[model samples]
Target: MSSTATHTDDDLMTVPDVLHVLRPLSKRTFYRWRETGKAPICIRLPNGELRIHRSDFKEWLDSHREQVAA
Candidate 1:
């Protein structure tokens, strides 16, 4: 990934931004995960838009990692 694609912990990701990285995943599925509390934590902006912090997104992804036996 290029520096431009890297996000800091404090960086806020919009739905489209996340979708870009999570391609092949539909917006409906993402929203469904959010509704079920399975997606990364997100904050609703004053305009009702959702944003997820980079750190939280990383944590969420990490939590779903599968362990393999050596």
Candidate 2:
């Protein structure tokens, strides 16, 4: 398979990567929210790995902003 195909098929991202994308929030805060069920829902892959979809995270952020504005 081509490199793009391989990467597209494996679009899962790690917690650190998500943290990098959503900076201003500490890694410890993310982990704490994850543990407390306050973080965005995550997907558990067949290999027992955890990942957060970028689109879902963005949706969560938008909804949260709306809630705060209300």
Candidate 3:
């Protein structure tokens, strides 16, 4: 017998996963934003892992979109 598994959107990412997706931004830039208090707020799990919500990240990107009418 063969088995298959399905993955949900939430299952698609973790902090490092998100970082990998945003490759144009260096790791240093991510840390720098944290230090400067300019990064989108992250959530800290009970185990102390930091995570940025996918929705929040999308909102941040939308807000920074170019104003050009094209």
Can you write out model 1's per-residue Cα lDDT over 1-70, one digit (the tens) per residue?
Answer: 5666755899999999888888988999999998898888999999999999989988988999999989
After aligning candidate 2 to the native by TM-score, how far in Å is the CA of 47 from where it should be?
A: 4.1
TM-score of model 3 relative to the true fold?
Answer: 0.65
Best by lDDT: 1
Model 3 Cα displacement at 42 (Å)? 0.5
Task: Give one digit per residue, the lDDT tens place, for model 2 in 6-62.
Answer: 334236667787788788779899989989988877898899777977666766677
List candidate 1 stretches off by more than 4 Å.
1-6
- Colliding pairs, model 3: none
Clashing pairs in 1: none
Cα distance off (Å), candidate 3, residue 48:
2.1
Candidate 1 Cα deviation (angstroms), residue 41: 0.2
Q: What is the lDDT of residue 68 in candidate 2?
A: 44
TM values, all candidates: 0.87, 0.61, 0.65
lDDT of 3 by residue, 1-70 (tens): 5588654534424667667778777778887887898766677789977777667776666777899887
Worst 10 residues of 2 by lDDT: 1-10
